[model samples]
Target: MRVPGSPRWAYGTFAWLVFFVVSHVVAVFFPGEDPTGDGPWDLRAYVIFNLVLILMSAVGAAVVVATVRPWGRRVPRWVLLTPLWLGSALLVVRGVPGMVENLLMATGIRRGGFVGAQDISTAELWAGLGINTYFFLGAVLLAMTTVSYVRRSRRDAHG
Candidate 1:
């Protein structure tokens, strides 16, 4: 039996990984105005948050590379599966609720409060939009790639 391959998923995951890394780096260098509109932005907290984001993205990229590369075949299966499972769970937990809330707010069905509604400037609003859009897309892409990786791996093992 021939093991199935998903080159497109591999490449797309890599592309999103690049976007994730680059965007986080840019945010670190040029932190945007606060969207909370409550108090002075905490630079230390923001940097720490982005640092965590950068580390997570790095780990995600490594998982993607390991899933797609030949040498990855030699790595312990659990090592790759652990992060992939955790990432998928995180994406689903966050993204599903987020997309639901966004739809509800957009439809004006439930609008007591919404995330990122305190933008005081157009730039802030646009930045929030970009970040949200990137996150949603990345979550979806990551989920898809995770599925593809699992399927291909299973095929390789059983075939």
Candidate 2:
């Protein structure tokens, strides 16, 4: 809902990313039931994979925070823009379609035929839908933060 920096968008983005990092970290260490039991990925592999995700998320949070501070001007334009655009695009691409598919299934417009769709209980589908919503939301927040960054950068450049 917030589009401007007046609401302190960068700080908020940083905080949400921190929450994401914390949640993923907990999920990695504690683990959870994977009903599908999809692959041969053992705990070690799972931990490593999740750690990589955690690291990426952490870096994103750091970028938002670092670039908002007074010292941010020293950071190159590419350093700020690259991850902001790339991460937002990636999240939108990953999230939006999955959400549509899930919505279709939920409405019974489509059924029984999508990746990981078969044999999934309604509860699981709803859970997945919720997570996809989070992804889409994260993309939006990141994009907003990017806008904030660009505006600040432009103002600074003009001055």
Candidate 3:
């Protein structure tokens, strides 16, 4: 709440992004646990295509974090902020509705999910809720980190 961009928040965001990416990498390496509960998502075919995307996302997140750190001031601001904003937007746009729908289904305030005629199970509902919530949290952390970097840059320039 104390202005999203702070030293502590920056560090936290980096940590979260690292954890998220590393976990996803692990999933790619060992796709034996699909959070979606679809079972087949854990298979080799489904996982092979995800590695590239995950690595690319990891690079972007690292860039954002690096730009916020002291060592990254020399890096072009736009280079980092562009992807940061886009990633944050993407996460929020995907997360909010997914979270809401999953929450609604979990609470029994709604019925099945958008996934065709498949009836949503309790475990799957909870899993979806957690995953979506993670996305929302990631969006917040990334946005805050960007704010911190921009604020620091502006403050340094003004002085």
Candidate 4:
């Protein structure tokens, strides 16, 4: 059962989880092919990125589950959810831009400057967009839900 006012942490966590899962699925099944001379896709780099995503996703899930634990019951709501909320927000900022860049590169829509030439594929671009959108939605929803939880906690604490 949710606390009298649990805020929206659960919702936020759920949203992010969806994003993480989708992105992971896409990355794993259909790794984007970058044609841009800027850089080639490296298995090691992808592994590293996946690792980070997995870590964050796990943390988010843990935090959400913790809400049902005794500690979650004892701690102030805002105090409980703040870290997760902040982390989710950070992920949004970091992931969203990377996704956008990847999408652009994949679509061959990236503008050329002093560094002319791009290595991208239309298929990769579509994949990037889907991945990026997933990340963006997940991050934003997570942030919002976390903030809601924090707010509810604060309110309950004072009242």
Candidate 5:
């Protein structure tokens, strides 16, 4: 059980995955609008994408926990850990910057043309890109993670 990094790293990664999925779901489906009254969401796309993301995150967390447990020794090491961690890492890559930008915007340190504003600044544009990039990357990672998880499971069971 002596991994290079703390178990806390794995736990924190798991938490972040969960938080990101839940936050995005809320944002997409239940966002309380800004003063301008238009919502920051697209329910149709949100439901589709979030359904995939939530499933991926759940599976990833299960794999991480199982891999670290004694009973999971029967499972191949890579099967239960690599894809899980990698998917979670990819999410981190996508999410951290967006989170930073949103935090800045929330504090008013970074203004943007959200809520139907006409002119958005360069920094705001970057922030919007960051947010979009996060979601796209998240979906890609989810698909990859699912494939890897299934492949590894099959390999471990048969080999």
Candidate 6:
């Protein structure tokens, strides 16, 4: 079956994945404070966490390229779809709670854990908000892109 292409969606998703990759790189090197007043995770833990984030971003980019390119038609459907599906699930799972918590804190509907926490800087709060926003936007974009790709591919295959 010919794979229907969606260059705009693919490019947009690629851009977001690039942003995610860059953010993870900054996170690994700069190393921000833990919002939960959790004293410093081990260096190994930080390394592992950031590595996973970077890897996931790369996988997302790969999926976008595969879905939009003619060469992807030669690949097995399960191979192309599995990572996209998994990435969508993982992004939504990670994004939603953070998005909600930040929204609540920003609107003054509820105090966050950082509230009343000693030694937590304003920078930390703002950084958390920014990160959460990025995650939420990225998750939504990825989900939409994946759905569009799948629907278009199915239609093209059948028609």
Best TM-score among the predictions, by candidate number: 2
- Error at 35, model 6, angstroms: 11
lDDT tens digits, residue span 81-141, model 6: 7888888888898788779868766775654533534354678667878888878887877
Task: Give RMSD to native, each candidate.
Answer: 4.2, 2.8, 3.4, 6.3, 8.5, 4.5
Clashing pairs in 6: none
Candidate closer to the true structure by TM-score (higher is better), 1 or 3: 3
lDDT of 1 by residue, 1-159 (tens): 332457466677778878878888888888777622455657777778888988987888888888888999998877988887787778777666666655654455554215534423656544544555566776777777777788888888998
lDDT of candidate 3?
A: 0.71
Residue 128 local lDDT, model 6: 73
What TM-score does each of the candidates earn?
0.77, 0.83, 0.78, 0.59, 0.48, 0.80
- Per-residue CA lDDT of model 4 for 1-159, tens digit only, reads 233345455755665675676667577656667522246756767767776777767667666655645566676565556767677768689667866666556555673211333554556556666666666766666666665566665665679
Better of 3 and 6 by lDDT: 6
lDDT of all the models against the reference? 0.72, 0.77, 0.71, 0.62, 0.58, 0.76
Stretches > 4 Å off in candidate 4:
1-9, 18-52, 65-71, 76-79, 95-119
Ranking by TM-score: 2, 6, 3, 1, 4, 5
Which residue pairs clash in candidate 1? none
Model 2 steric clash pairs: none
lDDT of 5: 0.58
Q: For candidate 6, give the lDDT of residue 138.
A: 75
* Candidate 6 accuracy as TM-score: 0.80
Candidate 1: where are CA atoms >4 Å away?
Answer: 1-5, 33-41, 110-130
Please, what are the lDDT tens digits per residue for candidate 2 over residues 24-113?
899886787872267877777888887898999999987888768877778987798899888778777866776777677777766432
How many residue pairs in model 5 have overlapping backbones?
Answer: 0
lDDT of candidate model 6 versus the reference: 0.76
